[model samples]
Target: MQNSLQGIELFKASVSISHQENCASGTCIDKNLLENYPPELIVGFQLLESVERSGTRRFAIHCGSADNQQHNGLLAWVFNTDLRYSFKDTSSASRSISAKCAMKVFYKHVANVQPLVNPDLGMPSVTSLEELRLPLHIYHCIKTVLEKSTSLLPPSGRKFGEWEIGLLDLESA
Candidate 1:
């Protein structure tokens, strides 16, 4: 309920104290948050964002036929995010705009953690985002930190089949 997901809060309190900790997102609800939201909502959010960044509209339509469509995209997205982090806005490079976009959405939705590059450390570290990693990792990190926190549903409940197809029933469209 607090504005921030405090790491110390999660660590100090026993999970059993709140049924909240049992769910993937760690939000307190009468039932599991996974059961609270519709699958389409999650899928739609992801697919729409994906299409927006890539400027492609066929990914979801052909998703079923493509092998490992979603999985590959995820790996690629992660790679791209890493690349973008390493090199911001470099021209003539295989610029990972998709990853940057996803990370933006992710940071906005999950934990409200802003990415900061400390001049002293010379690397990035998430202050609030750390609290979200556990439930997300348990939930297979399907949605980014922002999506998990702000979105109505979590990734485990998302239904990809209903979307307008793209490349291989992957729902990239």
Candidate 2:
């Protein structure tokens, strides 16, 4: 059945992110080339929120498909980044902080949701389920966090960052 397939797929697709390394940006690292550093606060808000704060920055993400049980859909976890500011020019102190957190989604019932494109039926390929699920969960999580954190928050805005969502690939080394 679709549920069984989705459950199996969900079990295998578990994914996570981490802060691999960090260093002073003043060094001679190539300016144009941004290293693929591990997810930072912007990309790691949810996983970090679950941890007990420690001296330095380090945390583990332990998310799975509803404790290995089956559900049509469920939220794994989510959190938002602090307001960041970066200057556009050397002369100006004016800045731009990321208005959003980069998100990653771990869907419960994935494979059960058939892809829009099937050779036999020839349905037009719609957006991936991953895309649909990421924004939905992210919005829900952000709204809940902001509402609880501060009473005076701005109205919701468009997604301004990258969200690494979908069935996670864990085997890559």
Candidate 3:
């Protein structure tokens, strides 16, 4: 699996892709790479330098009373590998340098495609942290892509969910 969610919503920084061998970003669709892609196409993720790993990489999406006793923070860590691309700290996410090639999705700086399984569980790749903490559009986009392609899902099967859930349905804890 190579491509994941790549685009911009109003709230977060932009996510783009690199077509270079094993750049684990996005792919071409009608000559446009703007469309999303799968994880099988993922290669090695670019590691973020210490200076680049600053600020609110993780965001508070929903404060809750469900999923667990309370759901607070989601640090959606997605990335690719490119040693040449340097980064600088910036408050504005829009103007921020592309960390797409800096962050190793699972926090590893290795330039190799690592398994997106829970470090603890190790198998039957359930809906773990790898799929957590993302924008609405990006989240939905990943579900759609995973449905079409052979990717990890809950142990029950390929179903993402029996019904759709909105933010309002969540308990505001």
- Candidate 2, pairs of clashing residues: 46-79, 84-97
The Cα error of candidate 3 at residue 110, in Å, is 30
Model 3: per-residue Cα lDDT over 28-83, one tens digit each: 33336453333212211111232245422322222222223333333333332232
Clashes of 3: 16
Candidate 1: 10-residue stretch with minimal lDDT = 75-84
Indicate the TM-score of model 2: 0.20
Q: Where does candidate 2 stray beyond 4 Å?
A: 1-112, 115-120, 127-153, 158-173
Residue-level error in angstroms, candidate 3, position 154:
17
Candidate 1: residue 6 lDDT (0-100): 36
User: Which scores better on TM-score, 2 or 3?
Assistant: 3
Write the candidate numbers in order of decreasing lDDT: 2, 3, 1
- What lDDT, from 0 to 1, does candidate 2 have? 0.30
- Candidate lDDT scores, in order, read 0.28, 0.30, 0.30
Clash counts for all predictions: 27, 2, 16
